[model samples]
Target: MHERHTAKARRRRGQRLYLLIVLVLAGGLAWLQISRIHSAAGVVSGQQIAAPKEGFLAPEIQFTGLDGQPHALSEFKGHPIILNFWATWCPPCRGEMPALEAVYKAYAADGLLIIGVNQMEDSGKVSRFQEQFHLTFPIFLDKQGQAGATYRARGLPSSFFIDQKGFIRKIVVGGMNEPLIQGQVSALLGKE
Candidate 1:
């Protein structure tokens, strides 16, 4: 009788363990799905907002700069914008910093804004990276990867050329060269 009781208790514990494992897996999957859904979000206006792409209004992006100042894409609507998504750890991103800096310097007088959005990283590291590259343009910290995911920046050094009217004129993935960035800027400024 004692042997049977012990056997039952062992079976019950085993069943509970299996059930706990299943629940944990299910919870993890649920959280992952939710994160993906949030990443697909766009502007919350009543208009027909599209999943950020060319010829469409660039999705609203709100993030704090390394200085801890709040910023959003809507605030820069009247100026030509080069919305660049990058990270200090990405080699391609590092490779394009100088070119981006050059572009910013070349067009600052022309009202061109190169906004760098760095993916989830430490503020100090980003600041040091900026110093290393001598980047003068604005660099916003995407602490939660919201801006990066919202912009669909699957690859490093992804960039979006936004016109003064807030439309995404062009979307380029991977690294950009000086001529490519300058050409895009020229086109955004209607100089091309």
Candidate 2:
């Protein structure tokens, strides 16, 4: 009788251990499924509002600059603004900064405002990157990525061209060559 009781207790313990393992595996699978679902949803939602129209007045959003001053998109009306959403960690974003800086230098006097909205980066890194690149334009910090969400930035190096009327005229995503970007900028500037 004593031996039978001991065997029964051991079997119950083993059963509990097995059940716990199964529960852990189930939880991990659920997490993976949820993540996949979010990723898919993001992709689909991105396709919906990817283009900018001539008469489209942009949504108002405020973000902190590298200097800690508040910068609002609405304040730069009557000029074409290139709002570039980028991060220090993104290689594509890094690749396009030089081209963007050059465009800014060339057309800044012609009323081109290049607003670099750095996403998910520490200020120190961004400051150092700005110094490294000799980037003269104001760098806005979107630490919480709220500005990215507001702009519907789906990937790194997403950019929007806001025209003189404060309307979004074009949207660019990923790493595009200088000519393409410049063309878009010029088209929005109405220089072409």
Candidate 3:
């Protein structure tokens, strides 16, 4: 009888251990999913800034072009705009330039304007980078980084998608490949 009782107790302990393990695993998985969701929702500077939702007017950006011409975001009011913030020294920004150039060429005839806002870089470096990449899109020099600050670009290779009505439709905060750039451009042009 004692042996039988000991066997039953052992079974109960084993079942309890199994339940504990399952609970721990489930709790861990839940935490991981929550973290992912939070990260995707935008956490910048240790604070959460709500993404500029669709239909919100984009902040004004004024800068001098590499061609010695003044430019303003409002000037591109009638067309879709891809406002990209980048620096010549940023690898990811360099990596994404080709894709930007391709998308610009593919859609420029359709009134797609791509503006590369160089973050506090000298005109010489910007010009060299543009030449090396064979980038034909307009390059704007953000000498004071005002445009970058206004756009709240926390990282290199941030892009804002603006529609014809001058409303910001989407914001991409990292490097983009051809497919991603094309997808965003298509959406901005209302093809998606």
Candidate 4:
């Protein structure tokens, strides 16, 4: 009987050790994620990082717009450009279109250009969405999702705010409201 109890205790101790190891690993991973988020939030809040860390030029993107005209990112070099990657199926992307449209309307004359890069969607859907939102900004078709891949966009509604000099100033990975859009636009315009 004593040998049986000893064996059971040994097994329980082994299980406890395994559980402890798992908890420790999980805690470490969670801490790492939180740290990264805090760092990204600092960039998003425009506190520490003023520009993209890489300092590399914005990737060249050439696509046809809904108006059936060829559009290229390089062509908009003299203006502050908002390069937005979105899809019709994404709820946040849909929700944020109106805010983007309003900002585009208010600031387009100020040399602010908003380019909506649609991901692998038909012209009919994109046209309907644009009509629904009355978005006057140019909407480019990323038929093969090349633009999204070039930008390394992992989520819908990702945006890059580029300065007039054709350098990327800021990148937002999620949906943006009017104030957030305006703040980034202000920074892009050198008003900040």
Which candidate model has the greater TM-score, 2 or 3?
3
For each candidate, give its TM-score against the true structure: 0.73, 0.70, 0.71, 0.71
Candidate 2 regions with alpha-carbon error over 4 angstroms: 1-55
Q: Write the per-residue lDDT of candidate 3 for residues 114-146, one digit (tens) a residue.
A: 999999988999999989999999999999998
Residue 116 CA displacement from its true place in model 2, Å: 0.4
TM-score of 1: 0.73
- RMSD per model, one decimal: 14.3, 13.9, 7.4, 10.3
| lDDT by residue (tens digit), candidate 2, 36-141 | 7555643543432323433456667788878788778777878889899999989999998899988889888989998998987888999999999999987889
Off by over 4 Å in 4: 1-54
Model 1 lDDT tens row, 1-192: 999999999999999999999999999999988776443334332124545788778899898879899888888889999999999888888888899999899999999999999899989999999888888998899999998888889988899998887878899999888999999899988896
The best candidate in terms of lDDT: 1
* Residue pairs of candidate 3 with colliding backbone atoms: none
Each prediction's Cα lDDT score? 0.87, 0.83, 0.85, 0.85
Candidate 4 displacement at residue 26 in angstroms: 43
